[model samples]
Target: MSSTTMEASAALDGFHPITRQWFTEAFPEPTRAQTLAWPAIAAGRSTLLLAPTGSGKTLAAFLVAIDRIMFGLPEPTLSENKPGVRVLYISPLKALGVDVERNLRAPLAGVRAVAQREGVPFHEPQVGVRSGDTPAAERTRLNRQPPEILITTPESLYLILTSRSRDILRDVDTVIVDEIHSLVATKRGTHLFLSLERLERLRREDDPQRRPLQRIGLSATQRPLDEVARLLGGAEADANPEQPVRPRPVEIVEAGRSKQIAVTIEVPVEDMTQLAQPVVTGSAAGAPQPASIWPAIHPRLVELIRGHRSTMIFVNSRRLAERLAAAINELAEEELALAHHGSIAKDTRLVIEDRLKLGQLPAIVATSSMELGIDMGAVDLVVQIEAPPSIASGLQR
Candidate 1:
């Protein structure tokens, strides 16, 4: 660790005891990425953090933001009726938004406890998610009573900006673009640039007295930092004459441990007789070869699960996730394990996540649904059944 890391670690140590306790309870220690990124983040400087998944970048970004909101310089008093969004957290996927909300509850609860003990007027910062799945009534309520922090997807953010709820963004003090690298090379990011420009214009128009909203971008992996910075800083023509055109500073923190990828390449025997046995009988007789060719794959999967106390098996698709999980359950019969994927309902996902965190689940066979920053217990090892298409996806796993 360098001097900067030491200072940051100390700063993190100085966080309200309850908040620190909450962090430890949730995740025992900060990842190397968190240690390197927190100081700049806590200073209110716009930053782009690049670190692999399972490295705690999500909590690092929000922890600093929440600390600033709760303990940084106080804001000037405004009317209670002046309803506006203070923090805008945008993700590319609605599922990511749901995961973010669940992850944030721990720190939010800690903040509330601190306020209560200190005798400060505790206003629990309201956080709500808006996406295609959000109900009409909830959307209407969000417009009428915007939360202090709004967690949403890029498309949903664009929709909110263009809709009647545009005023909700007028007072946004910080905008966090999560999974930014996921959008950078695509048309969606190009479109999002326009939205961000619109947001800056809105902030200037609505609250001319305050400074522009701070912009922070978070990603798992980014190469050629300068190019990533330029993409995030908006096109050259948009640079303002009055304000210095400084690209947001980006910090890349590699994981403490090198990439943990356990790959197993198995060539199936040419015999179609023994390998053709059905692992589960609920489905059609010849339904697309049961995804994983379970009879050949199950034994290896069972071996991996039995060997490791905690393991995550990333299958090719959701259908495979369910199929492999069913087969594993049948094989083990008594071990605590489950199938996890997007097809499962939100409530079920939360339950599985909780069980994983509690160390009650020995292993979970999942798809990309488990790839995001959900607190799914401690994974001792990750088994990639097939090679991920890109370095980004592989790093995330």
Candidate 2:
């Protein structure tokens, strides 16, 4: 034990008593990202949290919003959610949005239950998800009784912001952008920022008393982070030609250096040439994998899967994802693993995602599609056929 450990309980005093208790129970102590993120976000500052995977950045943003919605909103008299959305969470992937909703249930249920037992008046916040996969009837339900927390992909959000249903977002006060790095590197990200800007404008114009949207961006990997921070929510910096360019008023919590990755190399059997041939060593590396070594590899993969609760096998292409998944399941008594790529039907993909998260599936062989921040519970191991395109990507996986 250290001085920091000794005083951990006192540090959470600023949070609502129920939230503080839940925080202490769920997380033994605050993660570094949490320590930095909560204070800034609690103070209503736009924040960019750059931490590696499993650092709890999503919860850092979410918990603050949850606290506000439950107890910290500007309106002291209001206990329940307002007419429109209160917190809108945007992700690049529909699957990621669904994944976040699953993770939120634990905290929502726990915190609300604790609040109730403590004789605290509690207003259970409703959470709804909208994406391309959402059925028309479900979409209508969300509009009729909008949830306080809405999880959505960029495209779905854009549609919501632009549609007649835009009024549903008029009260949105907090917007969390997860996997911010994935969006900022492309034109799609540009479109997302525009949507965010539009949503902000709606909040501002809808009511003069409405609080400014508190934006929080979470990323596993980012470079030129200041630019991303500005895009996350910061207004353009002042045009003081004489002074050095100052970053906008966004609090950046970067703990990328603190993460440590221990990588282990495991070969099924020592000499691969005995099992397959020279092709395993050369010529078929990044392109098409050699058919020869797959037979030996699949059984080892099945063995590895049997040893783990859940596994995520990342391959270079969808074709390879299908082949590898089929190969691995062929060795099993029944289909224990499934292939997931962009080409899969949206409903099917959601089912596979749910099954994987619920521990119903042994493993999923996926392409880069699964690489984004979808909370598929815990994966015992990740198998990569080739090194990811970049260090950032590899870290995210």
Q: Against the true structure, whose TM-score is highest?
A: 2
Candidate 2 — which residues are off by over 4 angstroms? 1-3, 6-11, 73-82, 206-211, 234-248, 257-309, 331-336, 345-347, 354-360, 387-390
Model 2: lDDT equals: 0.81
TM-score of each: 0.76, 0.82
Residue 251 local lDDT, model 2: 79
Where does candidate 1 stray beyond 4 Å? Answer: 1-6, 9-35, 52-55, 71-79, 120-123, 207-210, 235-294, 330-339, 359-363
Summarize candidate 1's per-residue lDDT along 241-330 as a digit string, tens digits: 786665545444444456646565665455656555645545676454332455667777787788877888887788877777888888
- lDDT by residue (75-183, candidate 2, tens digit) is 4222345367888998888778877898899989989988988989867789999988889999999998888899998999989888989988877778899899888
Best by lDDT: 2
lDDT (Cα) of model 1: 0.72
